[model samples]
Target: MRTSHKMDPVSLTGLGLGVISLTFQLFSGCLKAYNLLADARGMPAQFQYLRIRVRTEQHRLGNWALVANLTEQSGSLSTSLQLNEALVQEVLREQETILTSFWKVSHPHTLMIDDPKPGPVSGTEGEADLQERVPQSKSSLEDRALRFVEKMRRYPSRIRWSTFDRERLETSISQLSALNDAMMSLLDSQQQYKFHQAQIRTSMQVLHLNKKVDHLLQLFQANSMQLSMAQFSQNLRLLHSMQLSAYSSEPQEERQTLATLARFKALNVEINLDSDDERSNTSTGIFEQPPLDPRSCTIFSSVPSSYSPEEVRSDGIYENIPVWIEWKYYEPVLHIGHVDPHTQVRISRLSALLSNPQKPTQFHTPSCIGYFNDVSNYRFGLVFRRPIDVSSVGVPSSLFDLIISNEKPSLSMRVHLAHTLATAVQYLHSTDWLHKAFRSQNVVFFTNPGDTDISTPYLCGFGLSRPAQNTEMTEQPDSIPLYNLYRHPLAHSSIAVDGKSGFKKAFDVYSLGIVLLELALWMPLYRVLGVDDRNLQRSLQPGVTKKVRELLLRESRYLEMVKASAGDVFADVIRACVEGFGEEGESLHDKVVVRLETISI
Candidate 1:
């Protein structure tokens, strides 16, 4: 197919003055061209892949434009683009050239322009106005894009695409893809710069706010404020009494009993606490699910006697952690046990959700089949949809067993393991539940241990998990060095700065870091430090402080091994986790989980 040897100089003026605007204009033009090609009719079914590919490129370009803030008329991207003006401008010009090659026009005069669309025309007005309009308004960009698309489509006859045209189209697509890649790389650099600047500004703002608060407090104290602690307490008590009085003021028939009032007061406290916790926590609301009624749920009173429960034991830690057992029932014929359609529907949906979770790409979690309650205990049974014989080979059910067995997952699987595990923890934290027992032992697989898909790990061991806003007393610290190895240093004492005794999300993050460290090196924590349980115990005798310091040192030293195993990026992610996800008010969701998702390996 004959194509334009040179881009119309008039059309070139459609690219705006700034590099980002110009790049966006060119991208919009390409996206429009791809959409037209993709949506073209009468194409043979054999060439459907080409259409799919063109549509994919169209989507990619469109998404990139949105992400790069190209849709905004006055965006920060314009200012950011100034930093790399020459390179960006060159890329834009190249894109502009490649964009014109989509059509078979050898000359700019091949197509007649009638009522040229009105859009943002950059540069000189006289000759430039004759050029195509670029998108100034978001809608205008799309409109102008369609105009280019229609212009390309208006040939002598409907363009019958053949195998001959495929090569040229593919070439143009590839060139456009390459140019877009370059533009995205530049965009990433700009984004990183902006993010860094934002972080610095946030830090400065926090500092300033802290100083202002401190100054205000000092001034109030110096002025001998009448609102003393005792007076404030008295006033607060008075308000509380007044509120109770108001409640009591209701008609005798309308007023609630003391029991109801007390219950309401307790609920109010919980509501206030939850709200405060949610407001203070950055990780909340990442994952939300509708609550299901326990009464309506399909509860199994009995499980298969043939299927024995598995235990995963960490080598250094002799404690045998009971694996969350799973088994599925196959009854093609309806049992007709219950008549409630809504309950059945809920069960069916639950089964479907468990079997086919709407999970992120390359991320997996073991599906919980249903809840089973024995006389004394209630537990969730997790299952893999496909039945695999675990009995054929003695397979370990958890990461702890897998690691101890000296069988290493492939590099890709290891990377995925780290990522999915981190993500699972993030989701857990996001729901305001802290996985107090997060470790390799808790990271289980539904499949057998011998050849388990490490990529699809499920975070278990929720027996110790608790809500972030819960005021329950923290469990006593386990003196076992094996368990302490996974615990954060502060967690060893079960004391926080606020004098609260509980595992925070930060503690869980530290545990995750240890698990990640073990994954990277393909060794347990005790082995990494060249110390067995006995050695660790002896080291712990000289105060938990010294032992914690040793652990920190080991973590730092083994970081090189992590880098050697997985690249510097993975190592940095590990470091961030171990260091409490950085001092900047960042959460594991932002620092560790999202960062892991970005790692290519």
Candidate 2:
């Protein structure tokens, strides 16, 4: 080239084109690599955002449910309160009118008249004085009667009468009657005109009228006092029933509505009460986004790094054999608070037992990896052999949501879930552990990649679990009545009647019965019973145990509905579990597992 050798134009052009093509290839490859790196870096942040969104949606749904319940309570309370107020007003008005009329009729008036001196006087002068006095007295009596009638025409506004005031009014009426009688006697004794007998009779009739008015006034006063007391009592009861404070200008109904709205707003739920269609649409959009991977998310960055060597083993060994790492990052799922030393020991023992592959006990449940203590905050981490989506785990969304959204699960899936739960309970019982907090909400579902056979069911709510003997000795009565819907009626009734905690293996079996019924009917307990959470709460009050027991019995409408929907086999299992067969040496969990195994999908 230095020598300036002459080159072909076509060859020079081919060389330039080839250089350009190579440069373009290098640039494209670099861009793709940069994109891959960026995605990898952003995944944690994206996962964190997804978790936040899922939590926000769950809070929104919870607030919406609360709002629905409050709205119902407001409607019922408003109707009853309004009716009671209207009736009270009507009775008050009628009683006031009666009292006013009686007061007017019994009112006293003053009269003036001239009389002759006590010394004897001439007959003509005495007769003149008497005639003048008679006319003046009659005119005064007529004027007083007119005034009383005019006063009676107006209704009385301030009619508050205490005992003293009532007595004074009665005395005044009696005095007025006595004065009328005296006036009538004076008129009857008048000799000015014997032919005025008709006038005398009219005066006597007026006197009799006074007596009648006095008697009526006394009766009205007594009746009015009784009515006032009755009204006061009724108002007190209404106030109690409304449960509203005197200082609050807002009605209970409005206050509850506002609180519900505020809660919805706090949860980031955009609700428009003006449009039902809009609300429905908004609710449907609540959980539209897919859940994030809890393991890869940075939300658990606050999780402590300190872990036992056994817990930190990266080889992922079960019985010394390698297995898939279901969970990559350890994170706290619940804040259990400062656990008792004994409880901590029990949990540690349980965790070790679960991780020991040498043990014959094996079930489809989450394995407790390890526990951490941060001051008063105690937490534990769990791991599964295969990764799972935590966002779709809770009962409100996984199980209840299916029924709420009108999505029916297949018969086989229900059977499988029921069988898995029974097996898990059986395993726990076999280990002499009691799951004191067993419920549908404690059951979780998982999915394994490339494994489309069946959804994995895990029994995971072991926060309240302990050795059977320990739980029996330290069991506390459940304070939440909503949970009682799943508990055995006898357990609830016995506790209510005797103030004792009736926690036993049979209690768990009864809860299983409720869950099985739920699975069979594809409905939540509240929905099946056609009641709200408030109704369930009210059912826990004193004297309501009997009624609740009757409602939960085998012949109750709830069971009848379940039997109609799920068939005889499922119903029989529920009945047997709920009403234990007093057989000795046979655990309820074992019986339940046996019954579940025999049921065909």
Candidate 3:
């Protein structure tokens, strides 16, 4: 061996050449142009539009043409060797330009201002009016809640030991206890505050819901709507089983199977759906908890008269489900920069009922059909349906995870989402009302994606829909506590008075576009990473919730990514949010007002 080394220079040179060739031969990933191949397929046509999401980083062969096989409803991906990463970036940049024109969302930390309180509602006629308006407590929303809670409680031991892990059960109980305690204390304080409020006015048009507290119980109890802890736990199970099984993102291959969450602090689905397609129910059990009613319940009672709805719902009280309209509602108290401590912010449920013209109630004795709010009494906060799902379901767990599977979603499904969302929004707009709070959860199955009327999209969380007439909606400061990254940006400023500072059809369009982007992108397109619910809530913590603002407004790396991925359509929209000001330094909050003015819609 030593003798051969002395004269092997030529051999060594050959070895070097071989090494160089191998390095140069590294295979580049094959990328073909994204095409709507599903438009022509034998499948039952699950969707209509042809949306596709191709990772710019992975698809470098920009020269390749998109070839579609309609019969297969898919494109056979192929590509010419692409050595230039720059060309791929360029292609992505071009696409971003298109996205910019359509999408715009508010920064999470953006400070929102609730306006001054609207006066009040008065008169015996108001009381009678309220009675005539409320629904027949027909849906028995509260009754359902109570029944659901009770049912879950019955099988506590079976449920608790049945789950894959029993540790979460103990922890969840602690959290639920904390939540219950906090809510009870808050309610007590709010009632005391409201009693003082009724004194300020004698003759008014609306009433605070606080005045008619018993009526709320009537609704909750009507059909045993209120759920016991265990039963509520069971309802959680129902929600899990009924969770939607579809994807609406940009990529054609990003379908994830997260768990369905039911707790108030959080909700998430954690299951291995990598190969399972049959879609069956997955249930987790919980231990039992005792049944408890509000003998200790206390709230505001300044009303001199009774609301008609309350009397009706309270009719034959013992026979009804002792539920609490335990529903949470909010109203924007917009008076931004007013410096007046007495008028800074507020939380008012009365205003919520008033805004919805469909509500049958009129001003009642203590509580009214219409409402007036005060900042000092109610805190400005959103009452979510459930707690935060901190199981961390939003992020991908691994590369081989279900998100990037061969069974990825299709374009037609994407298009159907757009069309359906549009149809739903059009309906709300037609009613002269806007869904100030828009998000994925807010939008749900309208006749089960399989249905065709496509007429009415069942929108939940109406609890947060506020009256934006003269009010401007401002989300909490810098936190995406109970939201997916995709929905953070749709939180923006809106108004009601044709021109008195309001959001117009365009804002709605922007929200829809972001939603479209969400469906197309699969994962949240513009996430304020590292700022999730656990460490990023306004009230939950002090410095943890740093408001991971969207870069569409700020010129950061995120903004670049937004431009690169969203293209020009939504890119332009990002520019607007980026500027953070109107054409002449006007507040962007007011920009929505101006935008509404210029558009016919």
Candidate 4:
């Protein structure tokens, strides 16, 4: 697929009467010798290095062919290379002779004739004759070479390379390498430089593709293993169902119905006929929160807190307080974080949009009553109406608290939490907003004062949340390293160095990636990095985000832990989020929500 440009042709003349034709014949001989070695089978592992050497030499020869313009249709190179013909011809002949040695070592039973006929001419007819004989001469040489290769192919496969042939093969390669060097030396400096540059570019491209292939292979192998285990379990359940059908004392109809259900379940299918019914929908409503339209939501500004000052409980849950706004009294939980001292206007607008009571009920997040300013502390709080599902619990605990307490959720619970958080993010992005402060601490579970519900994770910590359309607003990086641990490196600066340097959707995805990592490893950010809070807090400087990013990227242990705890599929999703979904074709819903749904305990 690579394109080549025309270059000055080397002159090959006065060395002999028919050296040009002889050089072409020798090139054909080299091609034949390369094929003979390449097609050989039953080569021992000890001499596999020889096979690699053959390939390298073949590539070099091909480059030489391209540089010399020998493969071009115009044949301009052949006409110009009439000066110093004998020296070039001798170098080609020597390379051909060395390559032939490989054939003799591998296929001793086959006989080959080394004969070439080069037609020489004088004066004006010489150039025309050279061009005319180019095709005929090449064909004659190729035919003889193919016949020799065909004979060698017919030899028995039982014969193979041995220790004795090692020295001969290496020596042949070295001699051809020397002759190749000689041939390249005759070319102009520009041609050699261009050839080497092309070779380097080719190598780097091949390396990049090879890494992609290797990663795909690892994914394939991991999936294959999981599929095999799943299939085995399904088979066992099917067998059990068959036994029950054969021996059960129940009625035939009932037994047949049970067997059919078993069969469907074995194939991972649900047979729920009333899946669209209200009852079925309500049962699954907690995970299917509808997305709210920001345009439809009302923004309330300067709604002061109606209650006395209340600090966060020791359990890290805000006390439920009465928030009286717009002539309505509603009791909502306060999820608050510190904000920039100057951005009161932006915070007020975002809270008003989220807390609009007319907005649809958000199951994965609390409905917002309105924004309440804590003037005493200069902190703004987002007042969210208690979720119906969590109404029975006293207060909710953050994921950070649960993780440090060592409350390890079951694999199924963790999977559900991951799915819910991913969906929450997708919904937020789809609704034209960004949860810029997304992290484990922001994710809360509504449960008893001392207990945690890992299954239902609500995304919180929206103090920094903003609309995606508002690109004019700049982001201030969090002072605490713990908060910035989940943020993208590009978003660590308040100053937008470029379009990507500012906070974007990918930054939100990066935060989601880190939260998923917490779910995967069941550890807080500090513990995952094997550091304490004091040490993490000490890293309050420029480029801290990049430093942490580099640490995570370089640490294979985190990925290993994810795979061990959550399996291959979950690890892959985490990788995509952390690294980012490469192209914009797939929405976060497809890349995260849909992929997480496919994963089972």
Best-matching candidate per lDDT: 4
* Collision count of model 2: 0
Give Cα-based local distance difference scores for all models.
0.46, 0.38, 0.26, 0.50
| Candidate 2: stretches off by over 4 Å | 1-339, 359-362, 374-406, 447-454, 471-475, 489-502, 533-549, 583-591
Q: Quote the positional error of residue 319 for candidate 3 in Å.
A: 9.1
* Pairs with backbone N, CA or C atoms under 3 Å apart (clashes), candidate 4: 12-81, 12-82, 12-83, 13-82, 13-83, 13-84, 13-85
Report lDDT (Cα) of residue 196, candidate 4: 54
Model 3, 133-244: lDDT tens per residue?
1211222322332343232222111100111222232223222222222211222333323322221110010111211222222222221222347744643443233231
* Prediction-by-prediction clash tally: 2, 0, 121, 7
Q: If ranked by lDDT, best first, what sequence of candidates would result?
A: 4, 1, 2, 3
What is candidate 4's lDDT per residue for 239-318, written digit by digit as tens? 24322111112212222322222221111111112133412211211121222332333333332321112333111123
**Model 1 over residues 1-601: C-alpha lDDT tens digits?**
1222223434544554222244444455555545445444434433333543443344445545544556423244556555764565465545545544444455342221122333332223211221111112244556655564344334222222332355455555555444444555555665644433332222222222221112222212211212345543543453343231111111111111211222222222232242344432212111222332334333223322111232221111011222234321222324654223433332332333333333322223444433322212322233222223333222225677678775777777888888788766654443344567787876766554356576556665544554555545235455455666687767666545135544577878878888988898888777777776456556544255336535665656678888888878778888878777532223565677567767786
- Output the better candidate (1/4) by lDDT: 4
| Inter-residue clash pairs, candidate 1 | 395-449, 396-449
- In model 2, what lDDT does residue 214 have? 21
Error of 3 at 256 (Å): 40
Where does model 1 exceed 4 Å of error?
1-396, 495-501, 533-546, 553-556, 582-587
Position 299, candidate 4: lDDT: 34
RMSD of each: 24.0, 41.9, 30.2, 24.9
Residue 154 in candidate 2, Cα distance off native in Å? 99
